[model samples]
Target: MADWQGVSEFVAVAETASFTKAAQRLGTSTAHVSRQVSLLEDRLDTRLLFRTTRRVSLTDEGDTYFQHCRLLLDGLREAESALTQLKESPRGQIKLTAPVTYGEQMIMPIILDFMIQYPDVEIDVDLTNNQLDLIDSGCDFAIRLGRLANSSLVCKRLATRKLIVCGSPTYLATNGTPHTLSELGQHNCLRGQHDYWRFREDGRERNIRISGSLRCNSGIALLDAAKQGSGLIQLPDYYLQTALDEGSVVRVLNNYQDLEEGIWALFPHRRLQPLRVKMLVAFLTDALTNKVL
Candidate 1:
């Protein structure tokens, strides 16, 4: 078996570009570091480094080996960190972002409860409609809704939100409810954010272009207009739940409402996440499991 100590010494020398500096960093003698690297090269039957009187440099094979060795060392350190964190309580500030409406109505309450449970934890949340990059924004995690675009970030589904089409009883009584996709085109539709509405027809997904006298980007405004008998509006269950319960708006196209969007907690791609982040995700998953909205 290869000597792990020798491999570590070789990596230190390769990174510092000098055995003397590597020794200084490792708190060992220069000769000892050089000998270890030499032993490492001998074990592999390859010359890993080229040395001159002034400085040291890696050979072609040495460069490739250094890359892999660096990653291996980093992973080892991360594993050790994870183990240490396992023994400690989940305590740290977690910076996260989420969409405005869902964050206010759904996530904020859960987060409040979470803070109460983990007294040592601090949470900083940004509630905005705009999607922010997790790494660039310095957020530990983010809550995202709807279909996510392909990306390198890791995602965990916390819950599901059903899309519902609804209108006020007064409007439905006068204009009639749409039973099929074709009938939807004849009535005024309140568009929100998207130009087309999503539905499922015969097990196939459909995006129908909708038009109306009022087109708004805010879901709350669209819902309000729909409640006042202005036009039919389609929205996620979180936005329409109270209205549905109060009989302010009645759901339409129940048979065709097929698209169910996921509420996801997104984090950076890493082999091991911080324990605090993991704990928060688990807490959210448990809190939201089987939730209707």
Candidate 2:
């Protein structure tokens, strides 16, 4: 009650300098305003005002007390203002992670555009194949190609990416095109197919364990191998789209191609999400959906 009534009395009397005027301003009677001010003075155990027939003057202690009251009210107003600004405009650092290959091939261009548009946000981009712990690692968001494995984190799918079983023109011309998946064993293969090659086998699904001359964990390396005619490699559309379009590589098994892999932006639940995280997720979503990259 002191915190509440004291503030009103101080503002009223200070602004009007007359209890009657202050009471009128506060929509209360003059006697009630005088009693509230007396209660405030008693709480502080100090005489705050001296009244004459014509005027009321603040005591020395009252002058100091009023200054502090002004400061407290100003601080509260400033805090509220800052919070309102934060809700309307975003600014801060955001931690983001993504697979190296997909980040470079797809997410990078979008990130570049997002940065340009939102100069206030600083992005900490970590590109790796390993699934990082969002809570422990302090990452705000993650961009994944294919399906996400973490159930705790929520994901929004951006776009479908087609996986292509392709080889360089030189390799196909040299080793000859295999009309059937069975003939794939006959030619040298550079694998990125993620251990299991998805093909329409026996009118159902087939996950074939595959091997290659140069087995690498890096998508770029496998793409390089396929480009140099090292072997036939399987890659998603993001990495091989330009190569396929330029005739650097030719798609094999068009009928056997499977469409399942998708690009996704993942984040934890909303309650604990920071301002920066929300801004980045929105930034990435628009950038990816609109293909601003």
Candidate 3:
């Protein structure tokens, strides 16, 4: 029989595409992982990977082997998880990812509350705008906003937030509010991250390309600029709620509000997910549903 230890090393390397990263994930030395992979390749009598100074890539045979091995590993993990489920108390670390702003303002608090309830469970959160592959990054799940593209991951809805177009009263007074989507071309639109703004017109979604002297990726910076009467800005309700309530900003084009975007927890489609991941998703869903926004 092939050594299961060697198979695991090969799987890790294949998934991460870096021996150093695989070793770090497995909590082993680079040399140890390399040796195991070498031994496995020798036993199989085929080169599993093409190693270079920069990265490791799988050979055709290796790719086929990895697909089967990953399924086997997943099955093993699921079997173990099934047994752990019987214990009824979830334990272990859950690695998760989320966008910087929302993660900080919304998800982090719920995660902290979950930790309080399950003292034995630990969480590692990666806050970034980049979308990471859950299996490649070894993350249990990710919190995503807006419409998701086609992916193999399973998604669970947590909440929905409306998209709003707004600007400071001064900005609207000076530049005039856009009454229709076509009028947007006549005004300066402060952009955040993307140059296109989403809107709904006549039961269809439309993306309008916007231009201005000032552009930023930070939502807070854009909001600040909008509040200072720089230009009209489009953002989600969560970001503008306080400003709208305090009369610092006013929502315009209410009729053009984009479809409400959903907040979702996305995870790998596995037959048996760990109890900690399941519980966290359930907890966040409940907590977010109770939130007014």
Candidate 4:
């Protein structure tokens, strides 16, 4: 019969890649750690590690076992954490990533509400237009403003947003409103949406290739341009709403509007999601759905 303690030592050694380090982590002597691993190998009838004076490396079976064992242990820890958190409000630093524009114009309000409710939880929000590595950067969750292209990361839809072209009344008087996408080619159409403009024609969604003297990845900048009459810009509804309602920017091409884009919260796929991430996601969804943001 295989001793679970011995198996645990093998797993620790595989994780550390050093028996001495594994022993330190396991709070045991080096000899005991080595003996446990050796006994586990004997019981399993296979060598789990290739030991050397310099260091250690896992064998083929050991490599596969290590992955499974790590998942099992980590999943167990997360499961227990979930139970513990059910009785208490989630409290901890919730690391989040979001695009610069959406974070400021849309998510920030929701975040403020979340902070008010979970006073014990601290938020670390990274507002960048770049795609951040959630695992490498230690982000608990990310607010992605567009349709998620990566299948590897798990995503949940929070809300849907539409893009519309708008321009200040002053700019319209000078350059004129575009009746069609073809007309936009003749005017300064400030672009961003990954440098591609969303359009719809004949009941089919399309991307319009556009350019202008001013281009930016940030929606806030795009809105500012339209406000300044620098150019007609396409922007998400949330950013344009205040401008649109106040008549600062007038929406054009209302009939031929593109399909609504999704706002999603994404996390790295895992057997068990951390409590902080789940709370944040729920808070954001609730806050937005309730028209708080």
Top TM-score hit: 3
Compose the digit string of candidate 4's lDDT tens values, residues 56-141.
99999999977787677777778798687776777778888998867886789888888888898898999998889775566777
Model 1 per-residue lDDT tens digits across residues 71-151: 887798798877869665888789999999889988888899898989899999999988897755678889999899998
Q: What is the TM-score (0 to 1) of candidate 2?
A: 0.64
Best candidate, lDDT? 3
Local accuracy of candidate 2 as per-residue lDDT tens digits, 1-293: 44666667765676456887777766889899889898888888898888777887788888788767766766765677557556655667788899887788667887777778777878889998888866445677778777657585778776667777889999989999988888877877776536667777667867766777877777778888898999988777667767777888898988887756667877753224556565566666666656421
For each candidate, what TM-score against the reference?
Answer: 0.75, 0.64, 0.80, 0.75
Candidate 4 wrongly placed segments (more than 4 Å): 1-71, 193-195, 290-293
Report the Cα lDDT for residue 118, model 3: 98
Q: Which TM-score value belongs to model 4?
A: 0.75
RMSD to native, candidate 2: 17.9
The number of clashing residue pairs in model 1 is 0
Ranking by lDDT: 3, 1, 4, 2
Residue-wise C-alpha lDDT for candidate 3, range 197-280, written one tens digit per residue: 998889999998989878888888989999999989888888887899999999899998887889998987643468988999
Candidate 1 residue runs with Cα over 4 Å from true position: 1-74
Candidate 2 off by > 4 Å: 1-88, 193-195, 201-203, 270-279, 289-293
Question: Stretches of candidate 3 above 4 Å error?
Answer: 1-5, 130-138, 147-157, 168-177, 186-188, 212-214, 225-230, 266-272, 290-293
